[model samples]
Target chain A: MVRLLRFLVEPLVLPRWWQDALLLLPRLVCGYLLAFEFGAVKFGLPWSPPDHSLGLFEVAFWFPGDVASYGGLFAVLPGFFAWMGAFSEAVGGLLLALGLGTRVSAFLIICTMLVAIFMQQIQQGMWNTLPAAGFLWAALPGLVLGSGRFGLDYILAKPRRHEHV
Target chain B: MNTSRLSLWLSLGFLLPACVQPAHNKTVVYLLDVRGIPNVQQVGLRGRDNPLSWDQDLPLTPVGNDSSLYRTVVTTRTGYLVTEVKFTVNGEFELQQADNRRIAFGAPGDTVVYRARFNVAGSLKP
Candidate 1:
């Protein structure tokens, strides 16, 4: 179990520290905007707009309906998917920002972004897909590299004294 | 995942039930026809109600595949016989009209549908 946990938490260390620092920039910016701005508007969080009157963890009233409009499978269980999508953005973004469970968070973010781009925004125009596309691109590296060396995953995955022998 | 991350996910899972709120006994559906209005401008509502404040604007979502139609639903525990409201374009109230639009609600457990055209008075459907 410990070995499996280490494999999951371990990050890919880059040759240079500057590479990790460079990667952190987009993760921080996208994660902050996702958690505080985009996700907060639709999902219930502590920092949601006062006028919205959203309780903690509550999905905004209109969000489920909006998700249903995506049609097919999304329409079948809109509420569940809406809650999951919002959770990925609001909570997954926070995890991404903290550099904890970076691969899992990135995977969730990537799925939500794909739906936002193709199902929702594609019909409107390419320009409409840019925001989701940007987030998708930002998460792609995290999915592969697991937050690099600048994240909590690296620290948590470091070999302990007992493991050294 | 590490123990800390796994615990965090579990805690969030426990909070999932809170995402669904109790159903409101009263519902008001506001539909706006924006065919006459510019597409670039965002349409919203400012009303005197629990969900709406006279000072803040509540943005309306666009109806499916229709750029000229927008809708919003406000649900409350108590019903109001009549509520004064005004539509806004880009956060600016429709001051060109002489009076604010009025919405009348039905009895408890009833859904009231209010439809009106932007910037037009007396355009509400019966």
Candidate 2:
């Protein structure tokens, strides 16, 4: 269990503090947009707009149908995928912003962004695909490098004096 | 585990169950036939109810390959007996002199289909 926890919380160390700080900027911006704007509109979250009338964790009614329209596997279990996609953008993005479980959150965001770019926006032209593409790029760093120095992962993973390294 | 880790796990446990949707006894299927409108790029519905705010437009999906017909499904908790709705084409609400179209819900589990044409007053086929 300890070993598993270590794997989940571990972050990639950078050579310089400025390098970690530079990566943190895009992560923060992208995470905020995903959780508050894109995700909250389709998925239920505490900060969702009042006009949407979404209860906590209840996805918008139109979302599952939209996902199913992608066809094939999405059609087979639209509800599950819709929920997952929404959760990734909403909760996972929040985790990304907080630098908690950074890799897992990045992985989920990457999957959703890929589908958004390929399955949905590809036909709509390059302009429509830009937003998803931007998100994908931002998440790629988190997936590879985890949160680095300025994240909750680093703080949590600090070696405690009671435990031998 | 430390206090922070335990609290994090406990918070996630509580949040997971909240994803279960509430039971909805009423279902409303709104259909808008925009055959008369030329070059309709978008169709949306705004209404007076939960999930359907007058201030926000809920976009409708085109039905199959038929660009003229758009549809959306709304599920609500029981006791929503009636609602007022207005259709929009390209973000402009129907400019009807008459009041907004009214939709009366049937019994629980019964699907109510409200069909109307764009900008045409008294054209609703309930």
Q: Pick the candidate with the highest lDDT.
A: 2
TM-score, A chain, model 1: 0.95
Evaluate residue B125 in candidate 2 and report its C-alpha lDDT on the 0 to 100 scale. Answer: 51
Colliding pairs, model 1: none
Determine which window of 10 residues in candidate 2 chain B has minimal summed lDDT.
B15-24
| Candidate 2 lDDT, B1-126, residue by residue in tens | 999999986665455434634335677898888887888888899987667888888999998886788999987663335667899888888955769887777776788887778877654755
* Shift in Å, residue A44, candidate 2: 1.7
Report backbone clashes per prediction. 0, 0
Error of 2 at B13 (Å): 18
lDDT for each residue of candidate 1 in A45-80, tens digit (9 for 90 to 100): 889876555778878766777788999978866777
Stretches of candidate 1 off by over 4 Å are B1-18, B21-126
| lDDT (tens digit, per residue) of candidate 2 on A4-58 | 8788789988999999999998899989999999998777888987655578888
Local lDDT at A110 for model 2: 97
